[model samples]
Target: MDKANQSQQVTELTLAGLTDDPRLKGPLFVLFLLVYFITLAGNLGMVALIRSSSQLQSPMYFFLGNLSLLDACYASVVAPRTLMNLLMEKKTISLVGCAAQLFFFIGFGSTECFLLAAMAYDRYVAICNPLLYQSIMSHRVCVLLVAGSYVLGLLHSLVHTEFAFSLPFCPPAEIDDFYCEIMPVLAVSCSNTQVNRHLILGLGGLVEMVTILAVLVSYSFILSAVSKISSFKGRHKAFSTCTSHLTGVTIFHGSILALNFRPRPTDTLSTDKTFAVFYSLVVPMLNPLIYSFRNREVKSALREFVVWK
Candidate 1:
């Protein structure tokens, strides 16, 4: 078979994207701009709030501040480009631009995965070993965990980005979705992708699964400990501390697992796109809101800021 036939047999990918209708461009651009602003403001506000608040100087809040920073960095990598593409006629990303996007996106994303796991462990110590919470979640330990998350993210991103770019882009370098992603890029590769697919499934899948398992195990112990607490107020406080993290975890993992693990041939591209939005856009925006709006401390701090204003 010829190259064209081979390409068709592999996949009929619309790398530039599905919609080029001028009529839809204006509305889409406005909508994406709104999303970008919200994502940026929400994540940055959370970071600032954590830094400025004396009551939030604890280890848990420290981790949360780091998480907020990660979310902001994660969203910045892809959302601006997506917003611009929605506004412009041509939605082309240069090779170097795409590589940078992939690097930061993967770095922040991987960091977040580990950071969430670290947060879960923090909760585990707080609940399961309340007497030792301070010692276990000491300032030094918290700093190490936060630094580890970023370092791991950087290393993992380096591996994936280097491997991804190793493949030559002979022609037709188009990413189907709004941003640079592994699956879409793999599909566009003219060379054999069996090794790449296997590595992605093994390494990427393992990292996600391990982090999720760690969270689940930590939460299980936390729930057991929570059940033993006799005071209603105590129980409520304990549960509230974790509710935001749990909600964010559910959204992030559920959306990503559903998108990636489903039967590829059976699922539509539209389905993937919707799920991508949840991870790449909505989750970052929601992280701050879910964690901060629901917390009394955060609300009180915001109120004080408003009063001062």
Candidate 2:
């Protein structure tokens, strides 16, 4: 077949969404709708709270606010489409639409990885070098870090999306996952995808490893500092400050590693989907709850804002 004919043949792809069980659609839709609602409310509420409250003007909350915004964005990219697909008997997505989803999904995800690493570094400075925290983590520095995260994310997504979409895809172009994820979409290509597979492994692995290493190193220093504190109350206080962030790191990295890093049989479609749900849906909702409930200052600011309103 000529290039034009092949392109015409695969102009649109179908999404084999989460499940095909007719009995489960209603319950799953209701459940996913509730989750998406909470994700929006929690993430938007966090961002609004951070922006409105003078008490949250620090670098830590600034990063947290950006993280919240990203959660909302990436969730929106996938959740609405997933919800719509649930209601339709024939779940179809245009080729262009799939590419768009892949781009934004990866862009936001990679940005979040770097942003989380930046947050870890922020915690390290605040805990390990309290005296120098203000000077080192200035407003200008925070802005640059956040900007760099988004920039790197865009570039990373561009490279992967371009390369992935360049491969010729023949018929039976149905993606097994709910969304246009890298691996699942690549699985549909007719051309030789060994290079693309290796790239996914190499590039994706490098990004995750570097960001995770940064978080680990930062926490190592933080733990060392906490251990040296003379008073029991001081140690407890230090640990409390880090607990929420540590929890966030664990959940985010753990889910991604399980999905991407682990060796998988080709038949583990259901398992991959489960991991995707946790990181994409569950973690975003959990992040705001963790930060807001754990931090006294955020609670106080929320209370103050409520009363003022």
lDDT of 1 at 127: 81
lDDT for 270 in candidate 1 is 78
lDDT of 2 by residue, 12-44 (tens): 888999999989889989998999999999999
For each candidate in the order shown, give its overall lDDT on alpha carbons: 0.82, 0.90
Instruction: Find the 10 residues in a row with the least total lDDT in model 1.
Output: 6-15
Candidate 2's error at 159, in angstroms? Answer: 1.1
Off by over 4 Å in 2: 1-8
Taking all chains together, the TM-score of candidate 1 against the true structure is: 0.92
Lowest lDDT block of 10, candidate 2: 1-10
Give the runs in model 1 whose Cα sits over 4 Å from its true position: 1-15
Clash counts for the predictions, in order: 0, 0
